[model samples]
Target chain A: MSAQPVPLVPVLAVVGIGLIGGSFAAALRRAGQVGRVLGVGRRQASLDRALALGLIDEVVDLEQAARRADLILLATPVGAMRAALEALGPHLRPEALVTDAGSTKADVAAIARAALGERLRQFLPGHPIAGSEMTGPEAAHPALYHGRKVVLTPLAETPVRARDWLTRVWEACGAHVLLMDAERHDRVLASISHLPHLLAAAYMAQVSREGDADLRLSLAGTGFRDFTRIAAGSAEVWRDIFLSNRESVLDELAAFERVLGELRKTLEDPDPRALEAFLEQAALARRLWDGRSAMT
Target chain B: MSAQPVPLVPVLAVVGIGLIGGSFAAALRRAGQVGRVLGVGRRQASLDRALALGLIDEVVDLEQAARRADLILLATPVGAMRAALEALGPHLRPEALVTDAGSTKADVAAIARAALGERLRQFLPGHPIAGSEMTGPEAAHPALYHGRKVVLTPLAETPVRARDWLTRVWEACGAHVLLMDAERHDRVLASISHLPHLLAAAYMAQVSREGDADLRLSLAGTGFRDFTRIAAGSAEVWRDIFLSNRESVLDELAAFERVLGELRKTLEDPDPRALEAFLEQAALARRLWDGRSAMT
Candidate 1:
């Protein structure tokens, strides 16, 4: 980074312009850092929404955007990143720096390296710790990444030039970037992010069955609302993460099951002291975290 | 009953004036529904705060307040409800319509019936669908019950005159009242409210112990934040509820574990059709309920 800010880039290409991608384009445009923003997506409606919402200056073909762009941002779902890379791999300009907003890093980085080898050194795999239950172009918000942490998982072979440029881009997009290894990134997300989703879905499904089964859901307050709210999110998106990050998620899930089993035993024995201790520790840990800042 | 809006009751006693009771006192005073709101609590600090915050006009002895007041609202923890009722049982005036904010209803109503039979006709065991993670007198808010449901688990033997008077009181507090049998009330809450808490706490306990847990927690965004938020709430309050309403809560927990076990098996295999069906069913049920409004 320079002591003085660099001049605004002229053009930027956002591949797979969904919620994250669309929001990136909108935020950059709103910041007036990019003279022209181009969005690339398979769906015409998504491209239209991106253009209409002023998220981008134009809808450009993937290859055209890749060739003309000063930077390329991958904002597709994690499962789609590999296929997206295959399409953009050959056309990616040598001068252009590539980065992604996929949640998982190991698979994306590995796929990029396998597809483009030395050229992949230019690609930076990053996950922004910001999102909502809502998805796609309509849900995009400019302030989504403001004051939020963005994690970049870079390989040992990753180019210093690319990393610097990528950091600058994220900072311009109003994110505080942290860099870590791909395996570590995957492990962390599996425990905190992926496991929560699985737990919510499984738990919610228990109450969701049809019957004269007693449910005072009408009387559920904000606590219950907030807790189970994510259970209603996109299942396909969660399924993709769970399947792709299976090993890490499974490891975390097993850890969780063990804790739950212990809790179950404690409950059975009516150990008030043990139960209270468990709850107090959790409350303390949660209280130490900043309440206003959204935990991603 | 008066032909006009029943003349505002002058003397109101808030029994067990902790979080909800203090807030109720404040709301009543703010709305000018009561001239002298008496607060009864076992704690001195809470009584002091209630007086300082102007939640009550006076801090009085429970029996003394019961003798003087036209209305009594119980806001104690579920476990303390029976003890509170037993202490105040003989002193409750025939004209004073009693209600509560306890989570569980069956036991409270049963205890009221057994201990204060004729006066039990005056007791309307109610559960207000309002709360925050924060507790005690300080966390009290006037708007907590706004747009939320207040379930009146009126027993079969509850007198029509008393039930009507109790309904008027709940209405004055800005709650939408719904009548249901006590048993059904417990069952419903077990599924919608209690089950979700168990799931969230169990999941939080499970995932937070793994390697790289801190890193994963750092990456957990809004999704994880909302999901685990209730896990940070008062452990004493929840633990008491679980123990007090053990039968219903345990039954719900068993149901949840069974469902989760099924999901675990499904995850072990990649049966797309079955998983999609499971997700679709859950999504449909969620959509059927009003987003956040249904929660209260």
Candidate 2:
């Protein structure tokens, strides 16, 4: 018996070939599942850089890229997704299986549905929960997606053919694929990702203002540094994320405030039992949680 | 040309041969600085393990260990420092240089001063701002102190000879030594170290308490894991630290609450400019701060 032949090579058009886009191109190219990787970006410099770096075979016009490619990947920021969808409307082939690398799914899926109509049957909004603190094509690497989880949010009208194709694309790139609804995805991410960024920034500000300014900084050691490392992310990108997920973020903030309040009471009065319980649960959860799911 | 001979090696006694103590012994052994490394602990099992692992040359009685050793390193919890000082006082040699790896400096320094009178001159209260989340003698590695900062809190009555000797010991163990006052060290660490742990514990508690607990955990990634790693530390140890540094920790907590309140407002209403500034400052601070100074 012989192994069955592989499916037809899909032509992939990657928009905004930065870290996510560039890494996807590298993974797809290495897997040999995609043919003729075409990249589309606003900056000619980045497009030239992507081509030079072998992240893509060529840079092509948006309409031409959309029409010719069998699959189109929207790898831009969530804020830019709407505009890109609008630009892609004129030439997106109805059968092309469209996907994205946006962090938030609900908004992107809505935008794709409104802009692409019947062609939206091919759309699968995705959030590949993988990345580094560093950004841009220079930071892109082939192994960046290995063992990572890629979340896909498919519409009710999405064809089984498109869903299977999208799953194959992600699996070929060495990602663990999972399905989620758009609203639930945003809510869960708000509690885990967006809220943590805000809290890191808030705590850092507190450290600068509340502590004996000179002494606090002087005494600050590794514990503080490790805790606040995430505060080192891009301001514009974080600001947009926080804004886009505002309601869920606010809900998490309020929940956190209640927890903090309880801790404050325990602190003021110094209850050993209460404090121990707080740390015990956290330790259990952290130990049991698999950190590999966050490969991006 | 004649070169001055290197200083004679000190017979170093490491009390409570756990992670910090075991690492200190191993580091000294690796650097070929100790004439003999003597291990002293309340538990016979730990002493045997430490000797077998070559963290020390011999396991000795606490009294005999203090009497024979030239350098005494009390690498135990802050809660145990006072008791250790009392036990070692009667047997400590007159010219012995004593130091500790306690997180809280003021209380330990005070306890040592009140217990040992003139013998205090031989004691150089020190805190090696270094450790990992892991524990036990087995977790100890010779490279634990490399490129880290070790803060020493020497009283005015502390002899210059003892301070200088202890500084050499830390330098031999691969640390950059710095002078700090006890009160100042407590306040500074309260903000940077203690507050962050409390905040993380609180954050984890809030997220874990949600109705859809599994959903919240499902979305947690690297940022969440890194942010909450320290929250998984020993509850007994952290509880003691927070309580010992109560005043400073309380003050820092209040400051943190104020900033968190402001951030909550920003999130609730969505102020991009204000949020941007908050993130920019945090990012700038984190990028500029030297990570080597974080060892505490």
DockQ of each: 0.58, 0.66
Residues B20-69, model 2: lDDT tens digits: 99999888878877778888888888888887888888888768877998
Task: Provide the lDDT at B270 for model 1.
Answer: 66
- Candidate 2 wrong stretches, greater than 4 Å: A1-9, A117-119, A209-219, A290-296, B1-9, B30-32, B290-296
The CA lDDT at B7 in model 2 is 34
> For model 2, what is the C-alpha lDDT against the true structure?
0.82
Query: Candidate 2's residue-wise lDDT over A1-296, tens digit each?
Result: 13535433468899989999999888877887766789999999888888889999888877888789888888888887777777777787767777898888888888888888776777789999898987778888887888788899888888887888788888888988888788888988988898888888888877766435655665566677778878989998888888878888888888988898888787799898887777788767666664434323
User: Which of the numbered candidates is closest to the native, going by highest TM-score?
Assistant: 2
Reported per model, the fraction of native interface contacts reproduced equals 0.57, 0.76
**Model 1 residue pairs with clashes:** A188-B216, A220-B295, A256-B206, A295-B220, A295-B221, A296-B219, A296-B220, A296-B221
Top candidate by DockQ: 2
Residues A91-186 of candidate 1 have per-residue lDDT tens digits of 877787778888788888888888677787768889888887677888988887888888998778778877877777778789889999988888
